[model samples]
Target chain A: MKLWTLTEGNKEFINETGSITKFANRFFIVGMKPRYEFKELLTQCYLIGYKSLPLVALTGFIMGLVLTMQLRPSLIVYGVESQLPEMVGISIVREVGPVITALIFAGKIGSSIGAELGSMKVTEQIDAMEVSGINPFKFLVATRIISTTLMLPILTVLADAIALFGSYIGVNINSVTSFSLFFTQVFQGLDLNDLLPAVIKTFFFGFAVGVVGCYKGFNSNKGTKGVGIAANSAVVLSSVLIFIIDLLAVQIADLMGLNY
Target chain B: MGNYAENNMRLGIFVLVGLIVLIFAFYMVGKNKSIFGGNFELKARFSNSNGLMKGSNVLYSGIQAGTVKSLKLINDTTIEATLLIDNEVKSFIRKNAIVTIGTEGLMGNKVIQITPFKGNSPLVKEGDLLESKKVASIDEMLQTLSRTNDNIAGISDGLRQTVVEINKSTLWKLLGDKAAANGIESTINQMHQASINANAFSKDLEMILSETKSGKGTAGLLLTDTAFATQLRMALVGIKSAGDHANELTLQLNQMASDLKKDLDNSNGFLNFLVKDSLMIKKLNATMDNIEKGTDGFNQNMEALKHNFLFRGYFKKLEKEKEKRKTIDQSLRIDK
Candidate 1:
């Protein structure tokens, strides 16, 4: 009876692999898809970018404000009070900006993708599409994956900019600095060494968020509990992957002597 | 449809703007390294480059002129560095300029400074080599300071030893020891002796002067009588002159003696008998013995005469003269 159950599990694994391959093959099928599906990309961008803006902005602002408040005393100990803006600007642009923005994106967009897709799977919408010979993976998973993949980096860049502005506001709360000079000091402290590695790492962060969210939601099982598992695991896995990818990127960049 | 297209356009614009800003920032930082601007190259060679790396700031007259573009080991000994100078200030660097590695500040980055010479030669070309001066290292300075301190310590030690030696020397002991006590004792003894000797000598001198004042002994009379002293002085002056004249005559006498000896040795002149006189020698000895007996008889009579009453009376007269001197001294005494 255990041998019979093992055979059933193996058969299910082989069937899943076979369908995943079919989905990949259907991705390039040109004639079946509508040109108006491009509208869906825009809608995804709006939903991802515009809908998530408030939370991203709020997180960015709080991150900037709190980081400045925390780091200010340490920098002051070094007698570099005038360099606070420049230091904060460099940290925000190079490290904090990308990382905090990516984590926020992971929290907002990752769960959104997971829940939306997981709910669809549970409601038999995915099965209906499959029964009609429509590839649900290509339609739903690909769109959400592609949307997160593209949207996250853009959102991160916007979030980084807003965060720096929020840091400027936080700086002015206790310190006085002009807008142009603050940015100049910020940009002066920034080098290609700091900027390139940080920006490059954000792409991997976005990709991880998309892939992990899509993978979890698509492979989700059970009933309503499966959707909960999908959403929870998507966020947890994406956050973990974000840190993992960042660590690896830092190591590789350090090995290349691109970042110090 | 329009809304969707417009949203896409906005996204595209956002992406473009982000890329542009990132690129611009990179360009600004790169331009600080003179990567974006036009620059000229100047080469300089140094015997010891002192580990000056590429991208070290090059300064001229305390102002930033360029950066060290490359450093290469020329041989077993020397290093050659290429400086990327700002094109606008190329004319300011003359051929005779000296380049040396210096630091930005005590805790700052390494930099190369160009020390300009007095009169300008031709401007340094792209590959021209410049002279290098050695920068004193902190370790070397510390070593020199330690050596100086060591030298000072040695001198102080030598001085201390010299002072110790001086303190231990006989001269210092003589100055500082029981010499004062010895001196005091000896001075007291000498003072007592001198007082006794002085009293005795004064009594003797007083007796002699009294005797001489009444015309007694020869030396006493010569010392006490004023006329005798004057006559003795005149006689001495005359005798000195006579002695000088006699010495001059003796020189002539010596010449005469030498002439007589020459004549006697020849035995052919008037002195021939003197050279041959064997019988005359016996006659001369008898005459000399007779003269000696007469002198001995005269000496005996003189001694007897000195012990006679008149001689004793003369001594008694000298004692009376002393008595008279004592009376005169008493009469002349104002305190009495």
Candidate 2:
């Protein structure tokens, strides 16, 4: 199939989209039928999810704190200053917590995954693996994808908790609300549907970031410069895909009546 | 191998913490009645639930005691809401408890308020159907408000028409006249003076009223002094009695005057008979002389009889009685 576009950029975009789609299909075909890379998957999970925790936590905490402080005056003007906890809680859990954490993860881990794999290809380590009867894609790409998919939700959960704790401190900067009371207000009238959909969506976020990063890395060219380009493009594309996937998720959640 | 195990352990802990936090969040967000405790079911039927959904708090006498279990439409107008109450506080909710849908905050969720009956009411059993009442929802209030808004619009329209009429009327011309304006100004000045005087008068009146309330003067005595009132009552009674006597005396005088007038009108006046008729005059003179002689003879005989022996004791006793009467009269005069 050919995409007829006047610009080479458009043509390249379509070409990349097709290749990524095929690559994602191949991943499903190959990764699931693996001589299960459990050890590699664990190490990747440790590197991707655990190592990403500090940055995600920092981003989430700042987002929550700043959001509360900004919303404080407006909420006070509306005479609902007490609703700071609840509004911040919902924004973090439902939208901000997962999405922002994913963006940060894409920046840190996407680039890292891309550069690492690209460098391996450039050095012919992947070729060496293939010649030595070892499946490089199975060991590297599959493990990374599975790790990111499994670990991102965990990371998002931790970030959400941290952000809420930050918001608690933010709330205390102006008024005194007990920890229990703050939590009670946050949880009051909240539904499982809200939490489940948000958590479930992060899986797709994780998958998009992983696949884009791996796809960029696998298709890299021109040696060392290729790795840098791969890393940069991986971050950009995966970040875009996070927002896109978020839009699709909102629509799907609305369709399923899981949006509260 | 040791480094690998340590890293794995750290990763395991992090993942465990994340999973724990996620579960905690879900639990906090969705926990209702019977989640961590035994719960008893209670039901209430309302005409309109008015957005009171399931999992709404069932606040028993303003305490969190339960949660709304489910809502079912029995008919077009009736909604049956089942409640799941914690077993710990189940005994407090009486069978006669009243259920009403209330709002949490001004712009917050709807809640079910259960008011406990403060009498010798029995404890609510499992699946008891409690009483319920429908409260006005925000939508209904807004609907009423819109109707009121229409009424206000109509009132303003009428006012505007009245104002326009006034603007076009001859009264507006009259108001612009110099003489009328001067007259109005004079009247207003006089009214201001009158109001000032009235204010002073009112102050005096208020002071007088306060004084009267404190029993200060005759009017105050009449109002507040019971003894003074009793004395006035007695005085009025005496005056009434005196007036009655005076009336009787005046009536007697009137009767006597009328009798004398009748006698004079009959031409039988003694002075007229004596002065106008000569024969009557001669007879009256002879009769008078005879009466004088008889009176003198009688006096002489009484004097002789008083000196006789049998009459002497009686005369002496009469004299003694006179003396005693005189002494008694003297004593009465002294007492007076």
Chain B TM-score per candidate, please: 0.47, 0.50
Worst 10 residues of 2 chain A by lDDT: A1-10
- Candidate 1 global lDDT: 0.77
> Residues B3-71, candidate 2, lDDT per residue (tens digit)?
888889989999999999998887776564345568889999999887887777888888778888899
Q: Residues A1-260, candidate 1: write the lDDT tens digits.
A: 99999999999868855754564455436314664355566677667766676788788888888877787888789777677777887788777878888888888888888887888888888899999977676667666666776666666666777777888887888889898877776765666677778878887788778767776677777988999898998898789888998899889989998764
CAPRI-style quality class for the chain A–B interface of candidate 2: medium
- Grade the docking of candidate 1: acceptable
**What local distance difference test score does each model get?**
0.77, 0.89
TM-score of every prediction relative to native: 0.58, 0.70
- The lowest-lDDT stretch of 10 consecutive residues in candidate 2 chain B is B28-37
Best by lDDT: 2
| lDDT (Cα, tens digit) per residue for candidate 1, span B1-336 | 787778777767766765675676668656545566778887877777765777667888887677788988999887889988877667888888888888755645678899899984988777667777787977779999999999999999999999999998987877776877689789999999999999999999999888877888997677767898899899999999999999999999999889988888887565666457766677778899999999999999977886898797876787899999998998889567
Which runs of model 2 end up more than 4 angstroms from their true locations?
A1-8, B32-37, B139-336
